[model samples]
Target: MQIVILNDAAAVAAYGANIFATQLQKKPTSVLGLATGSTPVALYQELIAKNKAGEISFSQATTFNLDEYLGLTGDHPQSYRHFMNEQLFSHIDINKDNTFVPPGDALNPITACKEYEDKIVAAGGVDVQLLGIGRNGHIGFNEPSSGLRSRTRVKTLTKATVDDNARFFAADEYQPQLSITMGIGTILEAKKVVLLATGENKADAVRAMIEGPLMAACPASALQLHQDAVIVIDKAAASKLADLEFYQHIEAENQKLQAHLATL
Candidate 1:
């Protein structure tokens, strides 16, 4: 994993936006895997700025969100669909037809999950996936104990995740017990993955993901297996990582080595 420790949340977001912009430059019609939460808000804002400057365009890009509360209406204030619209879609030029959020209130959830995967396949699969690690290490809504090879499916939110997400809902009663999320296998298929974390609240999870054993207890640890995953975190979130200075030195040395190789 390539870990970048930025000075603060805004810097982390700027770095993530630059990564996304770089990918868009390579593939203008790229399919993007998106996540919703406090962590990605600033990144979305930076993308909006790029859109406004005409430095990047989303008109041809397609997006698929990571997860959504199973019983909530798309219009519900607390729904992931609502979150995406307010934070991203409203500010960008992406076509409404190319944006997809899993059907939260689908009566036939199994079929819905299958169809969602089919849609992604039809769209050429995601070129880059953005992720946020939950305090308990869940990715999307696939909480702990989720099989590594799981596909798009309905998941029962763990108490920790429910509590973590409760802040968005007006009341505890409004929180959904279930959610629809793309599985670990689906995420692993992405050509590139960028995971971001910003606050002290995420420090432990971030540390576990990069350093601890690749156990199912922390689902984000699965990224250790991805060849093209990069993790961008603010200093606060990287606090628990051991030998952080060593990693920094290694990155610097590698850059110097690359420059020397280019000259030769």
Candidate 2:
């Protein structure tokens, strides 16, 4: 995992958006694995601005979201599908038919999960997967203790996850305790992964994901095994990482190397 600590959340969002912009410029048909949450809101906003400025276009791009609540439909106000539409899709030129989200209300979710995996494989796999690490180090709703090699499927949400998401619903409304998410192994198959986090609430998860052992207990730690995974965060989120100075030195050296290579 390449750890980058930015000055603030806006910096982190800009950095992550640049990754998507570069990828889209290089491969217009690139497949993107997306995540939903407050962490990615700013990044999506930046991408929308870039699209409007004619800096990047998603006309040929296809996107697959990481997860969806089990009890909702694509049209549901709080569904991941709607969230993506409101946050990023409606403003871009991408075909709505090209965007895929798990079938949260499918009568046969087992079959739905399998089909979701098939669609991903048929699309030539995700070029870059965008993610946000949960406070407990979960990725794509693959909560702590989730098998490292699991695939797309329905899984029960931990009480902690439900509580964390409670802020999004009314006090009387129910929050689904189940979700369909792409598995850790599935996410690792992507060509590149960009994980974003901000705020002090995420600092510990960031530390564990970047420096902790590669184990199921901290699902985000699985990124350690990926060849190209970038963890972008603001100082608040990166605060608990003990090797901050070393990471900064490495990034600086890498920048110098790239600059020299560009002149070659």
Candidate 3:
């Protein structure tokens, strides 16, 4: 596990984009595990701009989204599928068919979940996964108490989660009560993962994820066990972290070392 604290949100987003860009440069056809929400919108925008400038090309890249709200279809205005298209896919050169978001309205969700996991395997697993940590320390709708080794499956959203998401829907639209998310175990399978958090609102969760004990109550903490997992956040989000200065020094020294090694 590694920590990167930037001055603010825009810087965080750019750094996140650079992670993806570097991966794409090395493997243009890499499979990406993507996330949604306000936190990643800026990162997606940065990526889109890079594609427009020819700095990067995702034409051959494949993408798998983290989760989708149950009862909403791909075409639904607020569905994750629509969110991906509007936020990133539509603006990039990537083939629309290469992107995969879980079927939100699958009649037989049991089969759908299994097939979703199979698709990731068929793609040879994710090269990198982008993530956003909820204020409650949840990742991919895998709320508190969710099993760390679970797979892609249906999960009932906690009332706290639904209440937190209420602002995303119209007054009359019901907040999602359930969702299909790649479980903690499934997420850990990615070769690399970058988890982003920003603003003071996420400070507590950020601290818990990076420093707190590894328990199911804080699912994001599971990233500690991943071979390559990094936490990227802004100053405010990282405010609660106790080893703030040490994290900065370590990241800087590692970068210097990597630069030195590249010439060898």
Candidate 4:
């Protein structure tokens, strides 16, 4: 895992956006794995700006979201599909038909889960997966203790996760207690993975993921097994990491090496 600690959230977002922009530039037909929530909003906005400026295009890109609330329809304002459309897709040149999110209203959820997995494989797997870690170290709704080698499937939401998401719903609005999510095993299959986190609230989770032992207790720790996983975060989010300075030094050395190669 490459730990990239930036000065602030804005810088973190820009760095993350640049990664995607570069990927899209290199492979216009890239199969992207996307994520939702407040953390990734800025990055999505940056991509939209790039699209508008002709710096990048998603016209041929196909996307699959990490997860969705189990009880909501695609048309529902709270649904992940609607969230993607409102935040990224509607503003870009991508074909909506090519973007896939697990069906929340599937008549047979089990079969739907299998179909979701198959579609991903048929699309050539995710070239790069963008993710945002929850405060509890959960990724794609695979909460604490989630199987490290599980597949796409239905999952029960922990109380902490439900409470964390409660802010998104109105006081009397319905909040889903279940979700369909891509599992840790599925995520590790991606050729590259980029995860972003910000704020002091995520510090513990970030530390646990980057420094703790690889265990199912911290779902995000699964990224450690991936050959190309990048963890980007603001200083606040990386505050709890013990080898923080070493990580920064490593990134600096990597940048210098790339620059040197260009000169050669």
Candidate 4 segments whose C-alpha is farther than 4 A from its true place:
none
Residue-level lDDT for 88 in candidate 2: 92
Question: What is candidate 4's lDDT per residue for 1-264, written digit by digit as tens?
Answer: 888999999999999999999999999999999999899999999999999999999999999999999989999999999999999999999999999999999999999999999999999999999999998899999999999999999999999999999998999999999999998899999999999999999999999999999999899999999999999999999999999999999999999999999998
RMSD of each: 1.5, 0.7, 0.9, 0.6
How well is each residue in 14-70 modelled by candidate 1, as lDDT tens digits? 999999998888789999999998999999999999999999999999999999899
- Give the better candidate number (3 or 4) by lDDT: 4
How many pairs collide in each candidate, listed in order?
Answer: 0, 0, 0, 0
lDDT of model number 2: 0.95
Worst 10 residues of 2 by lDDT: 1-10
- For candidate 3, write residues 114-207 as lDDT tens digits: 9999999999999999999988899988999999999999999888888888888999986679999999999999999999999999999999
Better of 2 and 4 by lDDT: 4
Would you list the C-alpha lDDT of every candidate in the order shown?
Answer: 0.92, 0.95, 0.94, 0.96
**Model 4: worst 10 consecutive residues (lDDT sum):** 1-10
lDDT measured at residue 146 in model 2 versus the true structure, 0 to 100: 92
Name the runs in model 2 displaced over 4 angstroms.
none
Candidate 4 is scored at a TM of: 0.99
lDDT (tens digit, per residue) of candidate 2 on 16-120? 999999999999999999999999999999999999999999999999999999989889888899999999999999999999999999999999999999999
Give the poorly placed runs of model 1, Cα more than 4 Å off.
257-264
Candidates 1 and 3, the one with greater TM-score: 3
Worst 10-residue lDDT window, candidate 1? 165-174
Model 4 steric clash pairs: none
By lDDT, who's the top model here?
Answer: 4
Candidate ranking (TM-score, best to worst): 4, 2, 3, 1
